[model samples]
Target: MDVFIFQLSEFAQLVFETTWLPLVIWTVISFGVWFFLQMFENVHPIYQYHTRLALIFSLPAGLLSLASIHYISDWITASAGDGLTMITVISPIDISFTQVEESSGIPFMVIVQSLAVAIFFSGMIFFLIRFCMHAINLKKLRKSLNYRPISEMTSLSPENRGLALATGKNVQVAFLNSEIIPVTFGFRKPVILLPDTLKSQPEKLNLALRHELTHITQHDFFSHLMVILTEAVFWFHPLVHRLKRELVEYREMRCDNIVLSEASVSRKEYASLLLELIPMPNLNKELSVNMAQESSNLKKRITMITQQSKTKPIPKQTSLILLGVIFISTALAMACTDMQTQNVFDEEELDLMTNIDKTGEQGFHEIIIYMSEEEQAERHESKLEQLRMLEPEHIESVHVWKGD
Candidate 1:
């Protein structure tokens, strides 16, 4: 169990350090862009595409990002140490740059400055490309959709009547006033507009209006928006996509729960209303309205509603214990698995060892040797004898070398 926990912790740490942070940042940025786009434009195809793209690219990009950090750190350290010092003969791999008050020819500062400038320029170019796509999509959405105030409608229209019945919360609904195609707009105020034909059915209109209103009252639209944004940001993560899908399904379920709670209508009646309002083939693709699409989830939603009475509740203590276990397990898994500090050496010892100039041109480098009892017995040599091997005449100097 300990070993398993340790391994799990290491894996968690690696994920957090490499993928999780990057994915989180990417999700935030992607969601921010999507939110802004939704405010101005109908959901852009590019936004969806970008979300999928981000999920696809997240893992590789995360690994690369981590690698880059290590590389940059090494590069920075190396570049900081330009040639102010001469090469004292030591290991062929060992190279050190020393600081001199005055030195000529390509200082470490210049090298680091050049590299920093290049990185900055590269980042700017990437940002420009990203911004351009967002700008283009926003421009197109503005052309397609026109915003109107929610309070303009005096009576509930057939299109919005269903929404009014479904939600108890006070909300406004509106539609984009466009002859080309109707787009649904939602936010603090939501709207659903219909063509002249759809407004005639009083019963169907009530059901449809109730459905849309349920979306607003339960904040289904916003929950979906959050999921979509999350999906976009985590485009590189399969788990994120799965989670987003689950979140959407849950949102629908919650909305259904609300509808069931308020209406007192039989399950069959509600289901029948949903089926009756299935728009014609031509109206299927309209973006403004949430539809009873996704047949698989629809069945599940119906089943859940039918079985709502059988739902069981777990004890509070059990829930708390489960949460605590998960938290502790996750923390332990991360701690044991972290690679960075796994082989940590004393920094002072490492610095002293690395900086030691072994060649005689610098000075005689003293190495203090400590031995285990077994090692001392195996060697079986006095300190004097060891000193004599280097220089017999310097034997007396050994005691002098020791501090008082």
Candidate 2:
């Protein structure tokens, strides 16, 4: 269990270090561009795409670049000549659970460092538990809902055929008892769940139906899960919310664009349907995108629909340039990150450390000797002989490494 917790903490630390810098860079770059372009119009749609791209790609890029950095660093450290052997250190871990020895006085800075690590692991564990709970609730929600075949809904106008054409696959429709949220669910056999109240209102139902279908066509559910997992993993970071907000806002806008492009559906009618479905006080599902949302988000959706911009997507060449710049910059940022301390000890070295009688020159020599991987195999044989022969004052100058 100790090993398990130690490994879990290490994984959390790896992801935390990997993500924060890239997340910050993504936020700054996205916000900077948003500010620059919005000097023309405050709600310029371009930021939506900028936000989308940043949220979508930055973390994965950061993770990849971070991994590359560790690999390269290891190779460089290992390939160093005979003068510098790759050493195995047994310093205090960032997420250390064991009490520090009385001889090693814990410093103020070490307390803060350890506290930060505790908070990180705590946040990751908390979100992981929350994610599982939501998953179980979603499972029950699916079972409780009544499902019907798409064929049963013949009231759909012929105009909806365009919407059907939009979804190349057959989609199932389900009815829920509560929640006005019309959302898309499932990836293989995609289903859209609507409020049972929409049954009598075919026109409004058709609008809602087409909107959900558009989400299915785009495979928004997977992206929704990806963003949720990202947020869950990095719940401690403030900018994650900004990235998530961009992702959610742009997703709806892009879907709205697709839904509008398919037919002659008036923007006003679409906006009205959205207003009609405004959620009462909460949302109940996860891993799904719904038609109705909170009022503030709804306002943005309405604005985008009513005054939908003529701005085109960032051009492919331009997008490539931007992506390339982010890629290089992210790699460079990972390079600048400070090297992390690692502690790996064999049983023999552990025995040396646990020796409570160890003090002064003899104890210190055993510790440094263990640090040199090449000399670790010698154990204490040569060191014991040298310790017995030499006086403490006769020893050469020692290099004492300061550890946090």
Worst 10 residues of 1 by lDDT: 83-92
lDDT of 2 by residue, 84-180 (tens): 5444435311322356667554445445545677787788888878877876876787788678767567887776666666677777788767656
| Candidate topping lDDT | 2
**TM-score to native of every candidate shown:** 0.42, 0.65
lDDT of each: 0.44, 0.62
**Cα lDDT, model 1, residue 270:** 63
Candidate 2 stretches with Cα past 4 Å from truth are 1-47, 72-105, 158-170, 177-179, 279-282, 307-404
lDDT of 1 by residue, 1-404 (tens): 54444454555455444444444554554355445644753222223333333333343344455566657756875675532221111211322334545646454544554554445456556545554564465346545645444334444554454445445434543343322122233555565544333345544444445555656755545544544443444344556665455444444554555455554335666666544434422122222335454556667666665756632332335533543443343333333322343223222333343354433234344444332223332332343243335544322224223221
Cα displacement (Å) at residue 234, model 2 = 1.6
Model 2 earns a TM-score of 0.65
